[model samples]
Target: MAEQINLDKDDLITFFIHHLDKVYSAKSHLLKRLPEILYQVHFSDLEEAIFETIKVVELQRKRMAAIYELMGALKNEGSISGLTGLIDDSFEEIKTHQDNPELRDMSILFYMTNIEATEIASFQVLQLLAVKIRKERIKELIKENYNEAKADKALMLLITTKYLSTV
Candidate 1:
């Protein structure tokens, strides 16, 4: 019996912007930290995969900027995401496996998959919000980004299996 708050498309847009900020923040953090992680990877294939991921992240960031521009919303500079903790944990794993290149590679791959998984989940939510807002172009961008994240996650899984099979 509590009073109901009537929300409209403007409110939906506001919520959508908040989610976009979360992803923007995550990509920013990844762009900064991923290179350092890349430096720690010794496997040639893993190295190449990580490099590709960095490029894709850059692409997604551009797409995000375009989306923000289209929506007339400023990217929230102070937003932080759940990815911060996952990346931090990956760093810890690197430190723990410092002297062991193979173990470090394993840790790196594991964390990379986790990061992609996080992005995929976030993008799914964004996709849902974009659909709810009924913006076809925005929905298309969201879908593109979502599909890219899904592909990256799948590649990570494939590489993980490849890496483990040798052991």
Candidate 2:
């Protein structure tokens, strides 16, 4: 049987709050940037997938907001470092492949999946932290986002193979 972790609940809560702010901040930024990212792709399937991703992000933001309401924690007050670089790299990828539409579309898929993969790891951490801190409701909310991130990653993988065959 697995032993229960002996940790300072206060420290774990603080740690959870810090990352919660980071991910929520990142999701807010990426939420604004997603439409632009979606505009970069030309394929119907990829565009559809991106539209679904935007919907998932919107839901994720609301989920995090609910958690914040529960904790009485305010959102990040300043420019916080999180997933900005990954989003920027998505634009850069689009720009670099301008001469080739297929490559541009493919690169967008690659970078977006990269961002979602990072988010998956982040959400897993948030979930684990919630468990450690004994917040079952928050853990459940984060799990929805975590599972969506994983599903998006798998969908992106499927789109990659489809895009490649068409290329």
Candidate 3:
């Protein structure tokens, strides 16, 4: 079976927005509780990194929203062509962290968000570049990754709850 992408930006945005919206909600909740988790960790200089990360996320959210309106316009349509930049920007956001486990976890979360973005965008690419790409293969891959993330999320929630209770 071949999936054809006729350049429907509204559809693409809707697809991406569904995943991104969930991530934004989860991150917003986590951000509100970050202070409690990091009370013992130094955040003086890291405030800038947090600020930059927030800005990028905000911008990315807006971009996902604007993608619909951007579809039919010439200048705004350029946004679709700049998908690589969005991916690269996401990668750059995580590059600020070193080897710290907590930071690594945060970076991985950021990467996961980008993965959602790319997975949605890649649909069009797959349609164009590799129409024969097996749907089952992609579905299986996504399911495996999703299951791992779900397990990790559950463990994190348990640990965080315990830590908060002790605080």
Sort every candidate by lDDT, greatest first.
1, 2, 3
> Candidate 3, residues 21-78: lDDT per residue as tens digits?
4433443433443343233233332333344444444544444344323333222222
Query: Candidate 2 on 1-167: residue-level lDDT in tens?
Result: 99997879998888888888878878777877778757667788899998998899999989999998998888773363447666776777678998887888888888888988999999999999999888999999999999999999999999999888876
Clashing pairs in 3: none
- What TM-score, over all chains together, does every model reach? 0.91, 0.91, 0.29
User: Model 2: runs farther than 4 Å from truth?
Assistant: 1-6, 77-80
CA deviation > 4 Å runs, candidate 1 = 1-7, 79-81
Estimate the overall C-alpha local distance difference test score of candidate 1. Answer: 0.85
Off by over 4 Å in 3: 1-17, 24-43, 71-167
Worst 10 residues of 3 by lDDT: 72-81
lDDT of 1 by residue, 31-98 (tens): 88888878778787899898999999999999999999999999985444366667777777777988
Ten residues in sequence with the least summed lDDT for candidate 1? 77-86
Q: What is the number of backbone collisions in each predicted candidate, taken in the order shown?
A: 0, 0, 0
TM-score of 2: 0.91
lDDT of 1 at 9: 88
